[model samples]
Target: MSTATAGFPLLTVTAALPAVGAVATAAVPAARRTAAKWLALLVSLGTLALAATVLLRFQPGGDRYQLTESHAWIADFGVRYELGVDGIGAALIGLTALLVPFVIGAAWHDADPAEGDAPTGRRWRPTQGFFALILAVEAMVVISFAATDVFLFYIFFEAMLIPMYFLIGGFGDRAHSAGEEEGAKQRSYAAVKFLLYNLAGGLIMLAAVVGLYVVTADQLGEGTFSLQAITEARASGELDMATGTERLLFLGFFFAFAVKAPLWPLHTWLPNAMGEATAPVAVLITAVVDKVGTFAMLRFCLGLFPGASGWATPVVIGLALVSILYGALLAVGQRDIKRLIAYASISHFGFIVLGIFAMTSQGQGGATLYMVFHGISTAALMLVAGFLISRRGSRLIADYGGVQKAAPVLAGTFLVGGLATLSLPGLAPFISEFLVLVGTFSRYPVAGIVATAGIILAALYVLLLYQRTMTGPLEKEEIKRLPDLRARELAVVAPLIAFLIFLGVFPKPLTDVVNPAVEHTLSDVRKTDPKPEHPVADKGWFDYTPGGDHE
Candidate 1:
């Protein structure tokens, strides 16, 4: 369907505002680093305001892509600077916009030298560059979510790695007990690994994109990377290809998203990246950027290649189950708080993938909602963990004890975050996680049952982390003296916690918004659940009686 151009270019403006801010912030003099922070905040808030406008203007049960803006950029290749958002994309853009300002605030003092220490390395330098990189990443993330052109999406998708790489490698928090040299080396290793993994995926996807373009040109007499165009072609049977070729193309895209989702076997880079990067950057990676992987899986992989998606479902679902249990098991064993959170996200992401691949309306809707809920809950965990680590000058669980005695408010917030992670009832994640399981059960009962074990593992890890860190007696004088959650820290976490509760209590709005887009996506895939073999008897509920006559 062609885009409706009735309203303002809201999506474009929302995506571009951050880039503008990044340029403005980067132009500020190094001596005026404080001004840069303010500028970054202002820009981020402005973007957030624009994103809010998009959300407000968004019609919940409306078109698949709303407020779209399409202009020819590469006429020969049928490329356009196409931008728009379905409800899901709009919500994610809003989430990205919402988190950027807080991340800026959270990282405000990160670049400052520690007390009684002269600035010694790039890590101790001013933070203006960090803020600029964040804004840039935000812009790319917004565009990546909103882009309707596959090539444009790939550009934004690959482009995001640059700033994130710098954030992890250059400004990573050093382990408190490690020397500067050791920490720096670790950070570099993590950054390079992250880059290499994503680049490998991107390269494979690029080849797939080119192949898709060639196939489209051969069949339709034109090559295009427009998602709508390709989808239309596929629907019209003009984009037909051999089964092997189709599966290859689907695999190319799925492999990339799997790595980005950081699914089980491919998820090794995440813990290292999270363990090495600053908390704010880690928040961005885990909370916002990773959503792109699952989002693309639904949008591009399944949307473009339905038959291949169904063909690959069995293998994908098995891997997803492995991710769920394996990630949670690893999380249960982690001592580093950041790595624990990272592994938990892998487990959460496995649920998302399972839901998407389940090919049920409920599953896709839950997966989409899970993306937003995971963003909020994970941000809370990371921010709170960052606060604790900052005060204690350590990330090891063994380094903290009876922290609740010293910082009750902080401990309480952390516990709430932990509870959310474990999918406690009445929390946001529980709704989505439940929906995913129910949907998976309706289709793949065995995989669903196996994956449910991750919930027990989640509780084990989150509680263990809290118990060892917050519940014991205050033995270390240093631990006892740690300050409570400061105003800035509270400000960073309160909105996330409030969102978790608000969405938990009243998730209808988000689900309503997500359902239509998910339905549209599922319609494109054109897959349905297998029909039951037995006829149902006349009963209030589904009565599956063998040899029962139909009404």
Candidate 2:
């Protein structure tokens, strides 16, 4: 899975361009807010082009790590400015880049007054700052995906919380039912809670990281945070750790990722953060930024501590099952539209983690594909929902009724997004969800059976939300005047919908890229898909002799 570094630094540039653009956008004059928005959009498009180039250059059958760039930074501390992309990293980088322009377009006028005509105490200038912060987050997330160095990844991994905090607090959703003062307090609280929870997780991971370096130093005669170096040493039998130390270190890393993954008990921060932030930023939270956690579970946790991951599988599977059922139940009960999506996301993350730990090629490949498709599908649904809320000025499901009667196009687009979320056939998520279940069933049948019920629950929430909002009688005056999506908004939702259908029908492009990486991960964890207890192929149409050698 390891490969020599290539001379070009495409991954570095892909990550850095967004950071540089954040600075440039923030520097724009206050009056030129539109210019700043345009600049941000352009920079995002350029980054997307670079991502596409990386994807094109990647060979499905090539080295497990491709387009690599490594250089020494803190030589004494064994930290290097190392960068590379496996298939999962490449695919996720594409997902992050793909979502940002749509986010920018969706929030184009969000910096305007919350009420069309209400004077309120404003704490900050949002115009340039809002867009800049998003670009900064995109930068950090991109690096987090591509960083092959554990310390390098953790730096950006924890750093993304800063911009996200401001996005939640300073530029909250304008459609709040609460008074401005109360809303501000809520946003501030959500921001603080989000930061504190993730920061605590990061601190735990920091200790694990230091422990890793210490272990490597003791056995290899030099400390290193390089993922490639450590993994190679273990493979070649140059470094080995006692069972107790590996398991403890693995817990430290896994705990941090689980919190960031926002599994079950640690997921409380998500609803508040998404509820308070603008819709695009909500998508950023679940769709773009939060992916780093699950990605890390595959790249760092399994890659570095395979034995510990294996030992902890039963406990991890239990937690994932809880998240799936728990998140789905809460989502079904949600009255607020944004919180519903947030809860639903927690459910989906559970499926991704389940697949990764299922330890079959289909499972891990599906997990990687789930990350990409979820981002696209969530962006479509959430952005369209944002547009609907902006027009009617409410996030409560009860506030909306018979939206299709007034704005059929908007309702229709929303319907498609919801259906995709429910994993309806011919949508991208269905394929990934199916593979996860099939893979999980092969090894852990009982866990797979319990997980399958989550789909039924997903159907209930998505359809119920659509029915209540789009199909009921046109009750309120505000709902009646809701206009269809504008050209700009259509531009965002249409392509996402198209990708959903295209990828759903033909996911081979993604699966092709993801399978090799999945294989490498399975090798790292020393796992293989379970053989069937009964073989159907052995007893074909007429060959049903009970005593025959079926093996």
- lDDT string for model 1 (404-446, tens) is 9999999999999999999999999999999899778777777
Runs off by more than 4 Å, candidate 2: 1-6, 114-124, 533-535, 539-551
Q: Give the Cα lDDT of each candidate.
A: 0.87, 0.90
Candidate 2, residues 1-551: lDDT per residue as tens digits? 34434566789899889999999999999889899999999999999999998888888788888888878999999999888888899899999999999999999998754453445554445689899999999999999999999999999999999999999998998788986678889999999999999999999999999999999999999999999899998888797988999999999998889888888888999999999999999999999988999999999989999989888988888889999999999999999999999999999999999999887877888889998999999999999999999898889999888999999999999999999999999999999999998777767778889999899999999999999999988878988888899999999999999999999999998888888889899888777666544566765433222212122
Instruction: Candidate 1: count the clashes.
Output: 0
lDDT of 1: 0.87
Error of 1 at 89 (Å): 1.2
